[model samples]
Target: MNFPSKILEKSVEEISQLPGIGKRTALRLALHLLEVPKNQADNLANSISQLVHNIKHCKECNNLSDTEVCIICGNSFRDDKTICVVEDVRDVMAIENTHQYQGKYHVLGGRISPMEGISASDLCIFPLLERIKEKQVVEIIFALSATIEGDTTMFYLYKLMKDLKIKFTTIARGIGVGDELEYTDELTLIRSLQNRVPYSQDLI
Candidate 1:
């Protein structure tokens, strides 16, 4: 597509790089931004800059945070003995919205996907193991998405931690076989959390 201005073309190019955004969508967004007020665009630019530069992962659970420890990890009322393991910060937000769980969380950063060349070493698994060793963790609730990669990740984690004497459980299958945790409704997520079952190799 040809643009009258190189600046608009550059904006479209940059915006198109974002996930799920096509070139046409990016062009429309660029035009929309151009039509918006100057300060509104400036605010959008500033927020994006802040998101990239100011955000840091929580040292404890690997969740995105402004501080070393995320609010969930730092909360005194959260259950320290039980930790819900999730794929990313988005899953954390999804579960938090349900308000059905009171345990701490461990974000694996991402799941193991051999097709994507993402291995166990590519994730925050080491920090999670270290956290388990340091904390009085008794139960691990696998809150990963109900996808193949999610199942693979949970099984791998189970194999690694089976010798640690901690109880292993997984969220119920109410979220659907291929559903992502982030996209599940709050009611379904709440029920899944409430009806979690023991994690066994046979279930995979």
Candidate 2:
């Protein structure tokens, strides 16, 4: 059956579409918004609208940015020689929160999932290779998840960049299998990075 008001039902439906938010939670949120002051709701809506309108992917690393380049890429203090490769921008933010990595980042956009039809060509791998070729990158730290897809992507990247004389490493196995980098605690992430081992050396 339809709700008393179409607007309220529409608002609840829209909110429910958000990740992890169910219809009940969406209705609660919609009701809460209605109870709040109009100015406050307007400000919240305006912030989301601004985010949707202003934010864009960084040209260099594919991270979210308001401008052409992300803040990390634009920063002069970041170590240009080192690049931390991650599955998504959320992982980038997680690592940044630890303040353990002063180097720049390259968001792969996603991992390679052959079953899902996502391949090397589908991700930002080409741009990364191009960046490595053109820039003086000394090391690449892979901070992808320990999932099957994540492992496949890591191996693909390693093989692709093996010809280059750059040092490549992955975060230590402290993060359990199936664990996502974004969900990992700050201390654990920092420790994993600090104890990162050489990808090739560890394999042997």
Candidate 3:
């Protein structure tokens, strides 16, 4: 398709390269940006550019931050002894949204996927191990996605630390707190973290 302006074509091409954005949508977005005030467009471009240039990973947890340490890792109140291992900064955000976890996090950068040419060394695994040892981490909760790649990565880490006397656990997998049992999906039902009452007398 021919664009009326080469500049518009270039804008569409760049925007279309973003994930989940097709050329048609990119074209529409480019056109929409044209309707906006020049300063607003400039501000959008400037913010993206500034983020690209200034974004830094937290030296401690690999969380995206503008400083050497992310706000979570730098916090004094969070449980420093328990580290939640996740695949990326996005996973960190997802867990944070739950508001239930109070431990620190270790971003693995990505799971080990040979098909994608990603390996353990390519991730932040070594730094994570270093943190565990240096920080005397007492427990590690694997918060990775319930995928083959996620499992493969977790297994590899488990093997490496199995003899270290550190406790290991995974996030509870089950129905959401609000969902009824009848509406619950099968996989969640199968892998449910159900348990009997710890102190049955307390239920009375």
Off by over 4 Å in 1: 174-204
- Model 1 residue 19 CA deviation (Å) reads 1.9
Q: Model-by-model lDDT, in order? A: 0.92, 0.90, 0.90
Global CA lDDT computed for model 3 = 0.90
Candidate 1 clashes: the total is 0
Clashes of each: 0, 0, 0
The order by descending TM-score is: 3, 1, 2
* TM-score for each of the candidates: 0.84, 0.81, 0.89
lDDT of 2: 0.90
Write the residue-wise lDDT of candidate 3 on 5-94 in tens digits.
Answer: 999999999999999999999999998999999999999999999999999999999989989999999999999999999999899999
Candidate 1 residue pairs in clash (backbone atoms < 3 Å)? none
Q: Superposing every Cα of model 1 onto the true structure, what RMSD results?
A: 7.1
lDDT of 2 by residue, 49-141 (tens): 999999999988999999999898999888988999999989999999998899989999999998999988889888888888778899999
Error of 2 at 5 (Å): 0.7
